[model samples]
Every structure is written in C-alpha cells, then in structure tokens.
Target: MSELRFVVQLHRARRLHYDFRLEVGGVLVSWAVPKGPTLDPKVRRAAFKVGDHPMEYVAFEGVIPAGTYGGGDVIVWDTGAWVPYKDPDPGAALDAGELHVELFGEKLRGRFVMVRTRRDEWLLLKKRDEHAVAGWEPGEHPLSVLSGRSSDEVKADPEWEWRSELPAERAALRLKAEDERTRKAEDERTRKAEDERTRKAEDERTRKAEHANDTEHANKTDHTNKTEHANKTGHTNEAEHTNKAERSNARARKSADKHATTRERMGEGARASVHERGGADAGAPGPEREHTRADERERAAESAIGGLESLRNEAGLDAIGENGTWEVYGRRLRVTNLGKVLFPGRGDEEAVTKRELLRYTARIAPTVVPYLAGRALNLHRFPNGSHAPGFWQKALPAHAPQWLTRWREPGSGTEYLVADEPAALVWAANYGGLEWHPWTSTVDHPDRPSYALVDLDPGDGTAWEDLLVLARLHRTAFEHLGVEAGAKVTGQRGIQIWVPISRGPGFAETRAWVEGLSRSIGAVVPDLVSWAWEKAERGGRARLDFTQNAVNKTLVAPYSPRPAPGAPVSAPITWDELDDPALRPDAFTIRTIGERLSTHGDLFSPVLHTQQSLPPLT
Candidate 1:
C-alpha cells in the first residue's frame, strides 16, 4: 500500500491549538492536539478526534470568518508522508486503540503512537526512537513552510481569492465588465499620448521647412544683401534650438521606451505565473454544463433586449405626456403618474414627485448597482405615496415585466424579484418602490452570505452619540482580530456594521458567531452596548442585533433611497467620520448624497471585493 500523507496545522482559533491530520480513506482524519507534539516519549499530548476534512484543505492557510466552523487562522506547520510502524494494517490498529506512524517532516520526524482514551479523544505520545531528542519545541518553527507567512501575517490579510463556482453566465458578465473597465482606462491614456506626439511632430516639421526656406534665400541672394544674411543668421540660431528640442525629445522617447519595456517584462512574468497556476485557461470554455447553461442565459438576455427595443420603437417621444418615456438599460420605460407627488413640499423643501423618484433611481443606479446587483431585492412599495402606509413585497408583483430576473431561494421555495440588471431598479422605482432592501446574500447563492452584518439599534434612553461610541468599540474589537469592518448609516436612528467574508458557512454558523461577538462587545462596555434581543431587557443600552444574519433576512442596501423626510439615503461612512460628534444618521440626504458619492466614489466597494475571514476571538 502507498504511504499516507499527513499534516500538522497550527490553528489560532477560539483557543490556540494544533490539528494533526492523516490521510485515510480519501479524507484527512483530523484530531485537535491542544498541547501540540512533543519529542519526549514520557510526555503525552491530549488529541481530541475531530471531523474529517477534504484533502484539498491540507494546503489551506487563511482566516475562517468568525461565524464559520472553527473560524480562525490556520497554517500548515508540518507536512509530509507517514509510514506505518510494525502493523502493516494501520486501519485495524487505529480501531484497536493503538496506532504507530513514523512521520517524515521538516519539523517533525519520528515514530509516534496514538492511544485512544475515549471514543472522541486520544493521547499522542512520541516513541523512544533514534530520531527522538531530549527536548522538542513546537514553537521553534512558527511560520508556514509553504507560504513563509506567520499566523499573525495570515490573520492580518486573509487574501482568500478562491470563490465558490458561479453560474457561467454571471461569471462571463463579471469578467466582461472588468475587461471593459481596464480597456477604457488604457484607451484614454493612449489617446492622450498620441495627441502629444502628433503636436510635437507638427512643430518639428514646420521648423524644418522654415529653416530650408531661410537657407535657400541666403544661398541665392547676394552675399552683400544684409537682410537675407541676417535671416540666415536667425535660421542658424533656430537650427540650434531645433537640435536641442530633438535631443530632448529623443531622451523622452528613450525614457518612455524603458518604462514600457519594464511594464511588458512585468506583464510577461505575471502571465507566466498565471499559466503555472492554471489561470491561463480563464479565456477558454468551461465545463459542458456551464457552457450549455451560459448559452441559455445568453438567449434569455437577448430576448429581454429585444423586448426593450420593441417597446422603444412603440413609445415615441411625441407620444409621451405627463408620463414621460425614459430609456434605461436599452429599455424604454414608460413612467406614468409622473406628476404624482410622493413627498409633499415642506417649508423650503420642494415636493418630491414620482418623476423625481424614477430620476433618482436612474441617477444612482451606477453607484447602487455595484452593491445591489445580484442581490435578491425586497421591494417596499408605496403606491399611494410615502405619506400613506407602505408594505413590504418580497415576491415579484403579478404585473412585473417578463424581462425582469426572478430569484427563488433554494429549499425555502420563496421567490424574489432580482435586480440583476440596472433596468430592474428603474422598473421597481417606477412601480413605487420607495425603499429597496436586499438580502446579504446574492441570487447565485441565496443561502451563503457575503457579509456578517450587525445592526445597532439604540434604546429610548440611548442617544445617537452613544451609538457612535458603541460603533467605535466594535470597530476596535474587529481590528484586534485583524478583520476590517465597514460602518454605514441606517437612514434611521441607528448604525450598521458589515464585515465582508467568505460564503461557505451558512446563516446558522454566522448568526451564532455574531451573537457571541455581540455578547463579547456588550461585556466589554455594558453601559454602551447590549446583546439582548428584547427591548424590555435591553435596559436602555444599544442593542446590537445579529438576527439579520438569517438567509431570507434583508438589510437596507447602500445608496438605497429611504422614504424619510428629504429622502435621506442609507450611506456608507468612513471609520474616521464615526468619531465626529456632530455626525447624525440621516445627515446624508438624497439631495446631498450624490455629491458625497461623486467625491468619494463608493467607499463601501471594498466590502464587496475584499475577502476577510473571521479569526476565532483570542
């Protein structure tokens, strides 16, 4: 039989420990070694048997988001092949409560025996062998042999780039967007450089022609003609200037060429590394199922575009009345009751009409779409205007357009209108969708969330400043764990914080972890924050709600237009702004928010791209 591969990982979880895993039956049979490995044969380390992990996890070296199972930073401390000692049938020996294995590793090289003390726990002992020394230190080599990164380094930046496989159509769409952005930036740079070169060339040609004319005049005219001779002297002076300019241009060209060469060399090296890592196939066709599915989605997208085109031709500009026709995502949207005022004019504030609402959604779509796109949207419609009572609508309305994408939560069988395209947002807004709440998870994986969200709701006695204080504490706590969180105004009297994380651990795990985190924060500052679910027991402390972590639960998305007075938006704020004493939750109104976005350009975008895993709290 072939020798089995083994790995000993140093896991800095809720408690610092070592995990010893051996390849058995195609999986890594794992055990938690609390005290870690020792070279002394007399000393025994308590090894608690744990669940089997996939073989691929042997190379994993990153943070597990706080709400995930065994959420913490893990690094491969020792790894190598293991040989069975005496007992050829290691499987039988393991079942009999005694198994001997000789490890050949960088840090660990010796014969070890594991004796079962209980069904779930075992005692790991070093055998008295030639390789055994008087003392062995587990902390001697603390960094990972593969990455050369320490546990602290791994925790600081958990750069986990691998995402769960997305639907081929979605993947292609995302890739196309990224390529378009890069191409646009490159084109702009090239255009400017070309313009500069053309101007310089024209100047050089004009100077050369003038010099030739001056020379011709000097050679043909009499030598005694002072005017022509003077012109020749002037031409000579111009020639010197031209030569200097040419030399300067040559130096500039040489410098530009050198930089270009360096960039090209770097690009070549990057491409080679990508090729080695199997990223060279990024442009190639994916699996047959992905291809077939992608084709179907493409056809659907085409049909949707066709429907929009037909509508555009039908609704001519002349045919529009108070109900104006606006084109969005290539779709002509016929907005009716444009004169209908959603929010009445108050004092200096002008009346906000349905037309303005539609306009706001369209204007903010560029900023809003990045956060709301792919998320299952829960529409809060106010058909009779915001003054009247509005109701939440999770399901797509019966009158919803056929072109809109629908999302059905797996297993739950709950269907929702997905704002996958920009047009959907306009369509919903036109239908009186005043408030847009999107689930933390996306349509691609409804069950797995991208963020672990915490909602801070202050009690009656608590003031807005208290909320700020509590938010800062939470931020510091997360920073201590080496995880960065994003804070945003809820457009109400509260604040919300989100930590972007991987999507493998479901809601249950995340919720439990968040609850524990909330309690810990509450414990630290009992006067400021409370983990109580009920307002009665909250005792006026700010309640940090972790309940929004459920799969179906939704949060008011960033840049979403709230139905508050002045139509304030739920805006993301920098951590530095959190300490501002004058800061208020609804300070960023719809009228002023556009300017903030233009200046900052989506501060919360990193929360979508940065993958941070939650390390088990120390």
Candidate 2:
C-alpha cells in the first residue's frame, strides 16, 4: 500500500473560507470548509468532499464573476503526500474514516491529521511539535508550494464542484428557507415607510390647530377694542347717533389700520438700513462683531511692533538721542532726533572747539553713553603741560583711557594728543627707539603710512602654505606698482607688509587699495587661495579676507596687546624670522604686549602722525 496524496483548489469563495484538498492516487481530493482547518484536534469541522480536480488545476488562476454560486478566483491553497494511519492505503483510509499526511501551503506547513466526524464531515488539526509555534496564529503560512502564486492572490476556482450527486432533500429545504427570508425583508421595509408618514401627518395637524386658535383670539380682541372706542365718543340722537356711531367706529378702525401700516413701514426701513451697513439679519451679529474683529487685528500689530522695538534696543542704537552728537576719534557728528542718527562730519573744518564738542557730548550722554560702554574706539589726548586741560582729562570718565594718545601736531604752538594717525612705523636701525616721531608731519610722503595686518593659522599646514603664497603675491603686486613695500614677521607664521602713503587719501581709499592688492594676489594663486568670503563655502579652499579693510574696524595697533589664539605675543619680529616655518601663529597674547610696552615704551609711538605723500594709483 502507498501513501495517499491530495491537493485542494480553494476559491476561499470569498475572503473567509479555506479550500481543503488532499493528494490521493495522483489526483487532488477537494473540499470547501467555511471555518477553515483548525489546530484543535477535538474540534470537528464540517468538510464536504468535492469532486477531484485535474492535476493541472494546481496552477489555474483568474477572476470569477460576481453573483455566481461559489464565485471567486481559484487558488491552490494546500497540497502534500498523505497516507492513512489506520490502513496505510488510499481506499482503506476512507473506509476507516481517518487520515494522516504531511501538508504544505502558502500559510500551512508540516504534518496534519484529518479524522472523519460524520459521513461527509471531518476534523483537520495541525500536529504541534518543533515545526509549529505554541498556538495557531493567523497569517502564518509557508510559501505556497502548491499555488506558485502570492498569498494575496489565493482563491478557489469557481468551476470546482463539491459533489457530483445533487442532494434533492437539501436543495428543497434551502429553497423554502430563502423564500421566507425574502418575505421578511419586504415586510420590514413597508413597516418603516408607514411609520415615517404617520409621524409627519400628526405634526402637520397639530400645527394647523394652534394657528386657528391664535386667529380666533386676535379677532375677539379687535371687536372689543372697536366697541370701547364707540362708547367713548358718546353719540346722542337715535338715527343721527346711530350714523355717527357707525362712522366713528369706521374712523377708529381706519386709524388703527394706518398705525399698524406705519409700524411695519418703520421696521422695513430699519432692516434696509442695516443691510446697507453690512449688518447681519435676524440670525446675524451686530456692530459689536466688527469692533471685536478690529480689536484682534490691533493687538496683533501691537505684538509685532513690540518685538521690533526689543530688537532695536538690543542693537545698542536705541539710546542715541536726536539732535545730539559726539566726537568719535577726530570725526564730528550731528544726529537728528530720529530713528537713524547721522554723523554730519567735522564742524568748522579746523577741528571742532572743545566747548562745542563737550556740549554735544553732554546732550547725547544720557542716551548714547550706555551703549558706548566697553566698546573700543580711538581717542586723542593733550599733553600734560601748557594751557588747556589735557585731552585725556577733558574727555571725562565716559572715555576709556587705554586708547588715548598724546602728541603735538607739526607747526602748532600748543602740544595736543592726536589719535587719528595713518600708520605706525619703526625704523629698523632704531629698534626700540621712540624719538624719530615718524608720523608727526602732515606733509610726508603719501606711501609712508599704510600697513597690512595678516591673521595666520600656522597649526594647520594648509593654512601656513596659504599665508606664504599670499605674502609672495602681495610682494609681487606692489613691486609692479612701483610702491615701496616693507615686510616683517608678525613673530608667528604670518607677515605684515607696510606701504607708506600720504595722510589725505583717507582710510576708505587706503582700504580699497589693500582690497585691490588682495584680489590681484588671489587671481595669481587661484588653486591654493581664495578670498575670506569665498572661503566660507563648503569645502572651499583658503583665501585672503579683504573685508578686514572696512571702516570702523581697527587693526591691532603696533605694540598694542592682542590675545593670540592660545599663546603669547610674537611681538614685532625681525624680517628674517618670518621665513622660518617653525614659528607658530599663537605666540601673540595681550599679556605679552603689556610686558613689552613696560620695558620698551611703544616702538610704534613715533610713527603716529608722520605725514606721508600718497601718489595717485597708476
């Protein structure tokens, strides 16, 4: 005896059934189970044995039409070899009413047992062991070895039949049952419609009765009012009085009618006026509604304005009063009393009088001083001797003393401190000498006063390379222009180049020339360099930063202390030291500059106001 094999083609019929099948004697034994196969061995599920399908039916796939008996796409749900445990033969298993087989399907795998519960019903249960989980969980299925299609497309073939013999007894009983269901459905619909019509009719009748009662009451009141009016008139003669009374009653009624018409006209006029004003009707809101909307908008605007004011205050310009000005360095300003304060340039051209300057300072004091605190700016001071108060002392406590300088301008009788110097230069021979007073004269060569401050980062090899390339490029460009250029080590990896120019060119032009020179250098070394602004791009190559020339930006004054990234000041190193690669950029610091100043006075002090001639750019 050989094991019986079976395969069932399931349409599922819909989404909720299982097409049960078994392979026996090379053909698929089939059944359709509404509840599907159960894992509980004790549960007997009804399974009607369908006629066997051809072996090729295992691959059949297509949609079935709607409203047809057992209509659905066909799918091979399960298939595997099987052998009866009782007799070990195909026919013997049917006779014994029990079967055992190893099953395989899209969602079902491993051994299963089917035992007959009745002549046409059986219980199919999964054998739990190493191949099964603790309980049967939905959607757990092995790959469909039988269907060879996705589980989502699994269906039962519409043509598959469960039995060849027609059960006349069962068909007759089912037909009677369906007829009874149709009758019940029709009765339910009729009853619902009748109930709705009755409800509507009763409501209409009740409303009409209420209207009739209201009309009768109104008529009675009108008659009583007419009688009262007639008695008040007091008619006398019989016939004449009767006529008068009738005429009086008619007049009374006419007057009442006129009054009613007037009231109605007034109401209509009022409604028209409301509509013209865009007011709502009886169901609409009034004028207060519009007021509430406006109020909301006003609050929103106020909130936005408040935020803007707070931002302005943070920028430190909020306190600069209108019509007030201050002398910053040597420039004079005249600020109007408005949001944007203006600096109106030097007053009288010969330098503003101290009295006038002081008055302007006092006017803006309460408003501008708070914002000026802690910000660094240039300041000039008068020497300790001779007449008027020293420039430093006269400026008052509002000015910081650190930036003030004392010096006398050429051809001036009185010695005065001037903070606005074009350049700071130290002759190489003099080294620590201060007597040269290189910047004192206003008539010196224009090229003698300009300087360059290069910020360098030597810790990065690439940054150091970039600095060297820029230094060389700058040297070449200036040499081409016939400008006298001097280079010195910044005491770190960076170098400073000084180009002397006359005083009259102003800081703006001087900065422009520097920017032009930087650009020229950038053009020559595009690969290893770029401008500072361009360097901010992602993965950008390093370049010279030209914006450092903008007005109000002060470079560290020579001999002035600066805190370098992490180290002491390199001070002013000799030109030779700059060529050495070992020098680090972090050698400069504020502490080092202070120490140098105490020991050597200021090396850059003499160069403060030396007049230099600036030739026109060629």
Candidate 3:
C-alpha cells in the first residue's frame, strides 16, 4: 500500500493502557502498551500484540459496556499516516519479527522500529533520526489528536458509545485476582450478618431473662410477706419450704421454654451438622426430582403429592421399601429404585445398585464437587444400567429439581444443568447419571477455558504399553513447554494430560495453542502420535486430541464414575505412578477411590490452583 493509516487509543480500562494500531493486510495490527511510547531510543516500551481490529475502529472513541472484555472508556489519542521503509511488503516484515516504518502524521514524524521479542510481545523504539528527542515522553502530548479532548473529557461524554467490531476476550488474570477480593468481600458480609443476628439473639434472650427475673423477684417478695402470717399458725416451717420450692420450679420451667424457642428459630442451617428431619425432604422449594418414564407412570399418586413427604410417611411402614430417605447437605434425598443394579457382577461378587452409587457420590462429593461446581454439565446417563444404551443429557429435563442450577445460553435457547452442591451430585446419581463431563469453562466466564486438555485416544490395536510411552512423551512435552500438567487415568482407554492456564486466553487462542503443541509433538514421534481425524486412517496408533479446547466441549472430571464396568473413576495420579507395571486404566474404581482420596487427598488440586502460560509451541 502507498500510505496506510495508524492510530493510538488511550484506553482507560481495568488498567490505564495505550492501544497502538497500524493498518496492515486489511486490518489494524495492534499492540497494547502499558506505558505510552517515548521518543527516546534508549527507552524501549513493552507492548503485547492483542490481535487485529477492523478498519471501522480507526476513528472510534467511546465507552465499552462494563463486564465486557476491555470494558472501558477510550479516546483517539493520536492519528497518523505511515509507510514502510525500504521494504515493499510490511506484512512480510512483521511475520519476520521486525518492521521498519516511517511516519508522516500531524503529531508523530520520523522513523520508528518495532521488533518482536516474543510471541504477542514487541518493543517499540525510536530510530534516533531527525525527530528523535533525548527524553521525550508521550504524556507531554495528552490531548486527543482527533477530538482535541483529553481521555477523561472524552469519557465524560456519556452519549458516545463504542461500537467497534473488535470484540476482546475477557482477561482471566483480572478474574483470578478478583477471586481473593470477592472472597474477602463475601466473608466480610457474612461476618457482619452473623454478628447482627448474634446481637439480636443476645438482646432477645436478655429481655426474656429480665422479665423472668422480675416475676421471680415479685413472687419472692410475696412469699416473704406471707412469712409473718404463717408464723401465727403451727405449720409455718412446712408452708415456707413448700412455697420456696414452688417458686424455684416455676423459674426452671420458664428458662427451659426460652432456650427451646431460640433453638427453633436458629433452624438446621444456622447450626452446622444439624440436618434435621432425617426422613423428611427439606428442599421442597427446589425443582421436582427427575424420573424416568416408567417411574412417572408407576408413581402418579406419589408425584401428585409433590415429593418426599408421602415417601417419608411410608418410611416407618415398610421393612424393605423401594424408596428411602437419606440426609445429605441438610436435604432429604428420597432415592428411589435403590435395588436397581447398575454394574453387574463378574462372578460371585454382588452387583452394584443405584443405592451404592448414591452412597459413593455422597462420599466423593467433597473431593469432586470442586471440579464440577460452576461449570455447565453434560451428564452421561445410563438410566437402564451401563449395559443398556445410554444417552448424553445436555438440556436439563423440566422436572429436574429446582435446586439444580440451570444455564440458558445467551442466544442458543439451550439449557444446561450445573453441579453446584453435594445434593445436586446425589440427585444426578439418583437420576441414573453415572458419568459427569463438565465444561472446560465455568459459568462465570463461558468462553474462556480454565484448562487445556490433551486427550490421548488410542485406536483398536493400541496397547497398554504404547499408552505408557505416549504418557511419558506427554510429560516431556509439558516440560519442554514449561507448563505444569497433571495426569489422570480417563477410566477407559487412555490417559488425559491436563494443563491449567491462567485467565486471559479465549477458546480460540487456547485451541490454537493446544493444536500447535500437539502437532509439534506429533512431528517428532510420527508413528506413535496420529494426526488423522478419522479413526480408520490412524492405523492403530494413539490420536492426540486438542479439539476438546472448544466451548461446551467436556472431559470427564477427576473422581467421576465412568459408565464402564467395576464403576471405575477418572482418577488423578502422580506421573511416577504411571510407570508402575501393574497400572491399568481401570485400576482405580469406586471401591478403592474413597480410601485413596482419604490417604492422598486431591492429587489433582494443582490443576485448579497452579496455572501457567506456554510460549508458541507449533
């Protein structure tokens, strides 16, 4: 191009930064600079290449709605025209990591060099030519070149709405940092509310006690006055003893009643571990429980009664009832079809029932809920048992209990259930949902992935040893990329390597990074790592999958029960444990997970706590 446009926007976002853009290849190649550019060649400013912006934003200056990515006020700080120096193609030079340009604009003039030091990182330096000043600061020229107004002045104009087509990705670092702030704020609010309640309780108790004391005082005073009358009679001593005892008993009764009222007012939630009415469902306000077609038809009468209360009344009457109430998280779970076998026995071993699955789910809730909470779930339901054909449940049924969280995608009209509490997980188990696959992204940040997954899916002829080798190779790739990754036996054919990333990358960026990393790894070990999308073309090799990085795509959560035999779990493990000759995909089952988790705690805790960012690996 003969001459291209360039502009710099003073962005007053979560942080006050500057956005530098240059017209290249029909888009504005951009970089975010924390500190504005300096004319001194000695001072090299840091710039992060965010991405491209459409040409429509060349003169844009206004506020981006709050809660959106890059939600802030902006001003056209500078406007200019630029031409590449000597080089015919500026795009080719940028790709080569260096670009020399000459500016002929109202404010900026002379040659400047933009050098790429790392992916998404660059250094802008003044070339020490005719326009170079020894100690020039961008702050010296703060007014917008377009509107002749400062950024603050531009922001004050409320009617100027930003309609730029550049949709920025939500910054994950901001969310991660806010985690602490949000927690502290919530804790403070909770503390204050509890304090206020305690103050009220104390005041009520004091008032009641004072009233009782006043009554007791009045009775004692009356008894003293009667002493002189009783003295005239022969039964004076006996009468005095009886009168004092009666007063003491009356005082004791009043105190007991006072305490009972307080306890009643506090309720089960106020007093921790007080899951009252063990046989009665407390979450009646929640959505009605989901049931199979057979269940609905068979228990129309019970369904008419709403939920649980009818079953609770029958709890005392039946010796071996089909439905039973279990107290979980202060809610009475009226689990039905308790004797329904989900996992069949291989030999003399007894088959696993729905009752057993419910128990395990309640047992593992504390360990597994962290991974499931806040994420929209895709449940693998085996309602008729694992042997029967199962289906993946995305849209939550209308009858799903009100307590289970539901998310309706912004535009898609699709509703998804979220596992938020212990009761929620148990409810799913009762609904015959065996396998849990949670979205890679949480509900709060729907399009931003928290972790990048590398699913090692083996072909029909792939062996256990082959998987082991590939697992080691995965470890090498993680180390080479300088990222922290954890291994989990997928509870089936392969092992999954989970790389937790800090908040900043969108699904697109995350997917690109994962795909590039996997492809690079595949190149080194071509025979072992299959790149073919179709299974038939893989020729029995393990396929490295990065496609799971997309939004709504899910991987089985750690400690989740699989729909496979023996009720195996997707168990997280240390890398050293993978080398054990006896290690198999099905080694960790529900029977053994409770003890293992009890001993080791959560081995996958790092995946949630430790986050890293990898360089370009493709």
Candidate 4:
C-alpha cells in the first residue's frame, strides 16, 4: 500500500475570491473559485483547475515577495486524506477530464465530484443526496466551513502568498501583468483625490463674491440716505450747509468707491485662486433641490384649503330639508324627509297614511326598541324605506327579556313603559335595561356588567361648588352602603355616578336599592341637591333624577350622540376631568372613548361582576 500526499498552492486573482487546494495522487490539485464550494445542492461552483504540485509541496509554507506575482503569506486552509475513484493509470482521470473523490478533513467530510471542463477549468459539485444534509444551503451546512478562510483575512494579511511552480515562460508573463495592474490602481486613486480638492476651492470662491456684493450694497445705501437728509431742510443756511455737506460727501464717496474697487479686485483674486486650486462650481444646487421645495409649498397650500373647507362644513348652517319625523320616548322629532322616501313599503298596501307613518316613526325611534325587550316583530312599514317590501323584521330584543321586565316593573316599579313604539323600545333597551345597554348584556359579559344610568337637571346658574358638594355627598352615601361607585361628567350640567354590581336578585331589586340610596342621599344633602320627580319650575334647586334608578334604564355609551340637550353624550372621563367645571359632555363622545379604554380597560370593569351588599342609607 502506498500513501500519497501533496499540496497545490492557489491564488484567487479577484479581490473577492477564495484560494483552495487539495492533495491527491502524490500531487496537489488546486482550484480558484470566486464563491467557495457551496454545500447547497442547487449551486455548482466553477473552480478553475491550476497545475499540480509534487508530493513534497505539502510541507511548503512561506511568504511570497511583495510587488511580485501572487505575493502574500500562504496558510493551509484545509489538509485532508482523499480517496480518488478512477482508472488505475495515474494520469487517466486527468486525461479523461473527470475526477471523483471522497474527502475526509478536520473541517470537511464529504463525497464530491470534480469534472474537468477544459485544460484549466473544472466544476465542483457535492453529491448532495449521498453525503450532504438534505435541503442544505451553502452556509447552512456545517461541512461547508471547509472553505473557512474568509475574504477579509486574505485581504488584511499582506504576507499571504500563492507559491506555484509554473513554467519559466508563464512566470515571466504573470509578473509583468501584475505590475501593470498595480500601476493603474494607484493612478485612479490620485485622480479622485484631485477632484475632491477642486470642489472645495470653488465653494470658497463663491462665498468671497457674495461677501463683496454685500459691502457694495451697504456703501450705496449710505450715499442715498445723506442725499435725502439734505433735501428735508429748507432755509438760507440750508444752501451753505448743503454745499459743505456735498464736499464732505464727495470725499467720502471717493473713499467708498476706492474701497469698493479694492473689494471687487479681491473677489476676482479669490476666484483666480479657486481656479488655480482646480476648484469647479461643485456648490451649485441640483434640480432635485428645487423640485423638493416646490413639492413642500404645494402640500402646504392643499392642506390649508382642506382645513378651510372642513371649518365651513362644521359650522352647520347648511340647508335644513325635511327628512321625516321620528317619535322617541313619546317626544315627536322632525328629521330629514330622506328617511321616508327611502322606506321600503311593506304589509297590505293600504299606502301608509301620515298618521300611520307617525306611528311607524314612534316605533322605530332610537329609545323604543329596548322596551320591546328583544321580541320579534314584523315591520309593516319602515321609516327609512331601506328594508325589502313586506319583509318581516324582528326587533333585536333583549337577550334576557325576563330580567329586563322584572327590573323595569312595567306597571308598578316605574312607568317603565314610557312609550309603545319600536323607537321607544330601542331607547329603553339601550338606556333603560337590566344591563343598561342592549348591545352589552350582563348575561353575555358577566365579567364586565354595565350599570343603570340616570340624567340630572342642574338648574341654570348652579354653582360649580354646589355640584361638587352634591357629588361628594352621594359618593359618601354609596360608600357607606358598600356599593362600588364611580363618577364622571355627564357632558352637560350634571354629574353621573355609576354603581357597579353583579346581576343578583334581578333588575327590580337593584332598582329598589338604587332608589333608596338616591332618596336618602338627596334628603341628607338637601341644601346642595334635590330629588325632583318632575322637571323643575323657575329658580328651583337642581334635581336628582331618581327615575334613573329604575332597572332597564341606560346611560348612553361613552360617545353616543344625544340629540337632546344639544347632542351631548355620556362620556368616559378621567377623575381629574370630572372635577373640572368647564369640561362639557361634548368633549367626550363614543368616537373618542376607544382611545381611553385601550389605555385603561373600562374603569368600572372590576366591579361589574362583583356582588355587593347595599346597606340602608344613614
């Protein structure tokens, strides 16, 4: 058995290529690949085959001379034992233009095929299925690290060299070519440096010219001012004074002219100096700069016009056309007539009369739907005319109607049935329900149940101090009763307090509890607060609307539009904002409440699902 070892030195002539070598058949086979051997099965690297080296070359390691062809320190990137598969003849594989090998090294262990394309070119491919990892990319496979010498290391180490024993004729030609390449590279660097210097000099020249122009303008302004002062005064001595001033001015003008001339000369000299320094007009603005400025102005003008139009629309004095009339909570409302025209005809076509339309109007009112408490009903006529003709429409009743009915006390507790129309039902379901809002049901969200809502009438000229006192008193009463209470601005002249509790003992029980609490608090704070069942008449005290304690009564969600009381809404508020007398409900609305909720998930969320003991008010 014979042991074969050899080393072939390689130089990747390109600045970005890698040098590779391998020992085979008592000689070193070398290749120079721009991109090193890729373990990726898809990529075949073109490795140019250089001539071989004798077996003794395996121990050769040293620096090649600088300014010489392939001058650098040579380091062994990889050393390994290889088994070549081929015909018995030593040069048989080379002549056949094909080589097969299984390499085993410290870093690389794989089966590879090197097929010669020409006298000096070959292709290296990994037998991906046999030896490389399945689905491996070049850098992903650990075995690919065999091409470990990075490009940076090769460039940084000047002593690294590729020592090849080439024929004398080839060596001479390679040396001459390397020297020429070096000279050209140095020349290019010098040219770039000169160009940079020229640019700086030109900029200096422009600055000097601008400075001289500014001085000349100042001198001309001084002359014009003196002439104006002389003409302002009219007297016998004016002529004498003007003559003396003229002589002095003439001397000053001559002196100024001489200075101006000198400045012009200095500027010219500066320009000459710039030219001598090889400076060009590198400071001139490019076309892109002007386009950028124009774009900015156009955007500003567009923004201004949009803002003006928005302000005009918000002023709201536009044409008030008749939309239609809708009755809500027994109150008649005149809305846009568009709703009636759009209404889809339904039921036996008696052609709905105006009075019947009024009934429909009352039925679809925003407040009435909740009162229906989720009972399915047929919409014989639509106020909006959007529904299909004769289509049976069911009111979105309360998911838990029994709870709402029990809480409202339809006949006994409170006149919970304030209106019979669908509109009244919607309003009651939304504002007067066991769960407060129909959309948010205690049955659905046991974790964050809503509370009963009430609106109060704070009479005109009510002092902020008085309102605060009433709020504090009510808060005290709620705390004493062991109820979890929170307060907020009603977006109007009153304060709204929310009591959080679980749906225990049904809605009637809760309503009874709240009513008792409110009456007791009102009696205790009579000087500051009054519980008036009816609207106040003239200079009467502000009234605590006890009717709000009724079950199934809802406060609008923090941002819903309230057409009454000037389109205000029940807004979620910070404790600080609630304390401010100037803050109105208009500042809050359903549109703006989401942002606050995201930061603090419903301030009353914790008490919603909790049960509390309602102590009798002291």
Model 4 C-alpha lDDT per residue in residues 1-618, reported as the tens digit of each score: 122232223333324344556555545566776665654556688988766544444433334555565565443343444546554343577668777765544333455677887778888887753235433443332211112233345345332233445632222122234554676567556556443443344345445556766798878968667657766754346578768755634533343335224321111222233335443421122356435534543433332232322222211111122332232333323333322333222343223222323332222232223322432221222232323222211122222122223222111111122233434433332221211233122422222324544344576656766766667666555434434454566655677765544444434345456667666666776765544322333245666654443222345333333332222344544333334555554454323333333333333222222333444556
lDDT of each residue in 1-618, candidate 1, tens digit only: 444678898998799999999877767888999888977677889999999876656545566657657777877777655767778887788889888987756567668999999898899998875446555668766877444567898688653311224331221111134454676567556556444543455445546656776897877756557556767678566557768655634533343335224321111222233334453322222366334534443433343233333233223322334654455566645567977888755458997887667666665665566677788887777888878867565646434656788875442223468887778888988888888888788888766788888988898779988888788788777645556567789877888888777667776567668878888887877887655444555677777877677645667888777776677778877665675555688877666666455434455654654454556877
What global local distance difference test value does model 2 have?
Answer: 0.38
Q: Tens-digit lDDT track for model 2 on 494-515? A: 5555454434454435545776
- Assess each prediction's global lDDT (C-alpha) against the native: 0.66, 0.38, 0.67, 0.41
RMSD in Å for all candidates: 24.3, 47.4, 25.7, 40.6
Supply every candidate's count of residue pairs whose N, Cα or C atoms clash at under 3 angstroms. Answer: 2, 48, 4, 50
Which of the two, 3 or 4, has more TM-score? 3
lDDT of candidate 3 over 164-247, digit per residue (tens): 343422111111234555765675565564445434554455466567768988799588667777786665778777686556
- Using lDDT as the measure, which candidate wins? 3
Local error of candidate 2 at 325, Å?
34
Which residue pairs in candidate 1 have backbone atoms (N, alpha carbon, C) closer than 3 angstroms, thus clashing?
65-614, 66-614
Model 3 regions more than 4 Å off: 1-320, 346-348
Q: Would you estimate the TM-scores of all the predictions?
A: 0.49, 0.26, 0.50, 0.29
